[model samples]
Target: MIKNRDIVCIANTTWFGEYTKSTVQLMSRLAKNNRVLFVEYPFTWKDTLTTFLGKQKAPVSRMLGLKSRLELINTENGSKVYNLVPPPVLPVDFIKKDQLFKPFFNLNVALYKIALRKVMKKMEVKDPIVITAYNPFYGLPLIGQLNEALNVYYCYDGIGTRRHGKRIYAIDEAFSKNVDAIVTTSDYINDDKKKFNPKSYVVKNGVDFDTFYADAKNKVHKNEQKIVGYIGSLDHRFDINTVEFAVKNMPDTLYHFTGNLRNQEIKQRLDKFDNVEFFGSVKPNDVPALLATYDVGIIPYLVNDINKNIYPLKINEYMAVGVPVVMTPFADLKDFSGMVSVAENNETFVKTLITELEKDSRSAINKRIEFAKSNSWDIKAEEFGEILNKLLENGND
Candidate 1:
């Protein structure tokens, strides 16, 4: 019901044809009623220069394709995606010296401020609700300059736990305290944010049920061969040892991983298993068809502080296609006990996969589909809208 308002979302992800994450999903849905400007993370001169010189032809092409330093692309929904080119800034991760870093960081902020002013003027954006995800360094500087009606810090990950996160934790903490509202994807993140902002709320991730559920009835793989699939980024969070054990234990089952492999060492480690197949990144539209071919979906995440807080969207995506999920122990998995088979370790995870594959029935599929329908992106967007409405109604008092 929050309609006709201008909403400016500063996100870590790019809007130019990539895997849709929570920010993109929410903004897309919100666009049905509101005017949205999705500002992608600014590209530094180094990034542009590197992309120009890099062997990756696609990125170089995309960079060259930019019509303007700030190009606006109109979406099917009532939203505009603005891609910004940032001035050269010190790479915060590599630069350890404060004396050298602060000057460049300040210059980066000043340059962005000018760029943002131009974007606002071009779009005729005024008194907009500013929603920022991940990059607090960018958001912190723009806090008072924009004349934003409300400032929302959307925390999707335990960013402070990561290697490069230590440098920005203090900035994030300050941003959280100053923001009008803090929205988090998990309870752990929400609890942490509440220490700084009492207005923090947990709005967990959801799936795009329409696209996913449409293919739920399509049982393309009628073969007797069982396919155990894992989708999403194959990064450090992925439990390679658990997957190795599971694949080794179940020689008959075909293990398929569909995603961009961030950790080459892990992929190399798992390559020895002939049963394990790696299908490098598939388009988001092609996911449900891939899910339809899956006998069971596995979330073999390494249990750690970072992984524990993650409410995996793949779990919902798998369930949306009526595929039973076998996941490693995570705090948020407790809510999904009925739909997902939670496993403590490699032994239980493998056992659960076998059990789910053996007992895959119409009744179970229906149950999962029904549960997924209730947690669609539409529903989550409505819940998020309600919170935003309350904030606007109260004038962020």
Candidate 2:
């Protein structure tokens, strides 16, 4: 493990948020041997306004200067993550032209640097290894300014998602080349990322086994209605058509969802089904038990540009709890072909789901549990640490 080192992560998510993401899970594990700092999402003026208006949930007092922006967060692994909230930035997305938006972009980066530098100096963080987690716009500009040992572009997703707009591809390419290493969560993403940086590596996502494993053993499925659950952010990524087909075909089965519903149209359409139930986002600690109730877990994603390179987190969470897994063939599943069943189209998806419902044996469950145990966060974090060590050893900076 990389011990006694200062690790700074410039990430797109909150330290304590609705979901327990890969960044949070890995960073929390890494913090056991290193001083980790989680730089939260760069909030825009619009985000601040929404938070103020109670339309969004955020660190309101910290954003408003009522409370400190930087604090030490105690993690479950008995390590602390220094979470820092940078100043609110300009919401320049309204300006379509690059020439018009460049000034505001520079201004936001400038303001962000001041906030980050202040916190780093106060905490006496020196020779830190910086990991820019999916914010390539700011990641590109903040390159040589942080007085860091190395910068790892942690590209969990491809560019052009979320706030990474039209110019993200070029910006992402530039940032990838400049960084010491590019770490990805899937081989599909790695194929593109490694074209820019040779140091690119795929440290696939994993589960917190102790929690989910216990959930598998402890929680018994009590419902008479055969439950088919999906646990992830309900967005455009989720295939409503695939879900609708299954719901209509299998009227006896209960369809459950547990994640923040982003696409309202999905809710409007899927809610009309009497069998479908939506359990909105839950605490990270509570997820294992909730997933344990599922007879079968699914990744019903539309095979779009984003889903083509995607690796949903729920796969491991589901398997860890001995739940039979089924999914639409969105990304690479060469590693999991033995354990997870994939269907190419909606009709076949329903068919595969029914087959899963019909035949789930103790051997299959044991195999999945073993797979989950092998791909635990404990193992993934160590794999990541090895990559960090290799980067530092090579003197990539």
Candidate 3:
């Protein structure tokens, strides 16, 4: 373990719903030895009040939907420390959400600096370890400005996710240069970071083996009508067309989706298909249970500039639950050629589904389970501790 137990982790996220299992798992692991203080972004309580009121008046309270709740990154060892950051005293909503918000948000950055200074003083943190999960706008600049004893930037997703244009890119570049060391969830980012920071490490995301492992005794039987499922964000990165094709060709198969609908128009378009079932959003704890209920899992991703490189954590989750997965051949899945069924287009996906359905081989399912067992959160946590310990000794020399 790292010598320093008093560490402060600053994240832009306030809501646990916004975070992935890997993100939460990291905090859980760190808290064992570290006095980790998690700082969250400000949320509007008024939103919750408005949502409750709106639900009684209007049919749908879309405008006043309940705000996501902030979580105090919980620990395993029972010793804990955390705080939810209060919203900016300044009226943040007065500014319009547009290109101008970039500069306006910079003001929030200033407020954050003040807030951080005050918080550090209040907590009596002299020289603590500072770790950042997001970059450019939030974590990067905040950690960079703090000048902590040890600074780590964890790049989990692609850099393209934070873009609004050239301005965002500039901010990202400035923030990238300031960090002492970099850790990525994928090897691709580690390879790319070699040009910028030589001290880069790959800490691939893993699953909660206990929670997601196939309950062989309790494994629900696959329905006579095949259930093809996709869980996660229904964002631009997902291939809606591929899913549509799958639904059309395999009319017998029930297309089940469980996640927040990012695009209402896309959702409305999907309404025509009776086979497609959108179960909206479910809690993280409910995901394994949901996956268990499904016959098969799929990552119908739109392979492009954004998704081609980044490794998604969902693949491992699907595998852990022993649900056969079909994915677009992304770089991450390409390595697991035999472990998963790769489909180039809708036609291939449909054909492969039928073939897999007909075959229903136990060997393929076992391979996936074996692969998933090798990559658990416990393993990733150990790897993370090792890296943190090294960083402490090396002192970012």
State TM-scores per candidate.
0.93, 0.96, 0.85
Name the candidate that leads on TM-score: 2
Task: At residue 146, give the lDDT of candidate 3.
Answer: 66
**Candidate 1 C-alpha lDDT tens digits along 1-397:** 5888888887876775536598888888888888777777666556767766783322333334344656666654455555554444445556678797778878877876776688789889989999998779889888977889989998898875453446687888899999999999988888888999999987889999988998895343466788999888888888888889988999999988889888997779887888878888888788887888788998888888778778888888999998888888856655786778888888988888889887888888888999999999889999898999999999888
Model 1: lDDT of residue 250 = 95
For model 2, the superposed segments whose C-alpha errors exceed 4 Å read: 217-222
Best by lDDT: 2
Lowest lDDT 10-residue stretch of candidate 2: 215-224
In the order shown, the candidates' Cα RMSDs to the true structure are 2.3, 1.5, 4.8
Tens digits of per-residue lDDT, candidate 2, 1-397, equal 7788999999988888777689999999999999999999878878888987989977777865689999888988788888898878889867779998899889999998999998999999999999999878888899988999999998787665366567777888899999989999999899998888888899998988998998784333556888999887998788888888889999999999888999998889889889999988898889998888888999988887887777778898899999988998888868787889999988898899889877877777788898999999989999999999988988974
Residues 1-397, model 3: lDDT tens digits: 5544667777656425632546567776677776676765543344445446773222122222232212354454354556545443333444445676756667767766776677677767766777776645676557646657888777777676333454555555666677778888877777776667788898888887777773521343556787888889887777878778888888888888778788676577676888988878787777877876666788888877667657778888888877787887656645566777898878998988777666655666666777888888878878887998898887778
TM-score computed on alpha carbons, candidate 2: 0.96
Where is the poorest 10-residue window by lDDT in model 1? Answer: 55-64
The global Cα lDDT (0 to 1) of model 2 is 0.87
